[model samples]
Target: MNLRVRVVHCACAGGRHWYADIDDADDPQPDDPFWFVDGCATQTQALETACGELLALSDRVVRGDWLPRVLEDA
Candidate 1:
């Protein structure tokens, strides 16, 4: 289960990175684990949202086909 997160950040080009922070990853290399991204945010609200979403993404990645715990279907 590869849960890749596409984050919108300023320093994403070149060798710059903004990615996931999982403890276990596919490729072993010298890279910062971001859930799926990196970079500094200016707004608190956006940062909060990113943090929350990243957590969810992490759960989804590790849990495989497990249903989302944050919501219920009608």
Candidate 2:
């Protein structure tokens, strides 16, 4: 599976915040282990957090410890 991480920003009355989402590059979906990071005060912080999560996920995938939601459900 080709995984991609995306960072998004939002500005509201509460203030500015950032979020990150991890999904498949070709076909995205909401599934288990769908990593997310939110409420970051800065874009840099959100990107850093997303990078760390992506690295950890890659390690898990390499070690055969990661499972896609579809497989898990089956």
Candidate 3:
């Protein structure tokens, strides 16, 4: 199944990033395991990174290769 995902701009002490997460209401934890582009200087760059990550993730999913299994368990 292709899960719906959301990408948002976020910031931390390390700088800004594009953060992606499954858009599942059942699990709305802010710090939950997610995909992100860290230390990005601009939203545009972060977005680009997020898009690349989404493509890569979709590729893996299509190949039946779910990753970072420890995160799944958490």
Candidate 4:
């Protein structure tokens, strides 16, 4: 599975913040809960958060504690 993480800056409600997008390139899904991280104060923070989340997910998958839906059929 291919995963991609991107940090973005957003301006809304008279405030600015950073966010992260985590995309499973091999299994793109709309409205996936794992797809977004919000309310970060900086791009570095967003990126770090995304990486941490990805690492946690990876650990779960490796330990067989979690199974990705896309991989269920495999």
Candidate number achieving the greatest lDDT relative to the actual structure? 2
Model 3: per-residue lDDT, tens digit, 11-74?
A: 7776665655542235546455445445566667666666677677778778998555225666
* Segments of candidate 4 deviating more than 4 angstroms: 27-30, 33-35, 65-74
TM-score of 4: 0.68
TM-score of each: 0.33, 0.75, 0.57, 0.68
TM-score between candidate 1 and the true structure? 0.33
Q: Write the per-residue lDDT of candidate 1 for residues 2-74, one digit (tens) a residue.
A: 4333344455446443332332335465244433334434434445656676677667667774443222322
Return the top candidate by TM-score: 2
Clashes of 4: 0
The models' CA-based lDDT, in order, is 0.45, 0.76, 0.58, 0.72
User: Least lDDT summed over 10 consecutive residues: which range in candidate 3?
Assistant: 19-28
Candidate 4 residue 65 Cα shift, in angstroms, is: 4.1
Would you list the clashing residue pairs of candidate 4?
Answer: none
Residue 70 of model 3 has an lDDT of: 23
Error of 2 at 68 (Å): 5.2
Question: Which stretches of model 1 miss by more than 4 angstroms?
Answer: 1-42, 65-74
Candidate 2 global CA lDDT score: 0.76
**Model 2 bad stretches (over 4 Å):** 30-33, 68-74
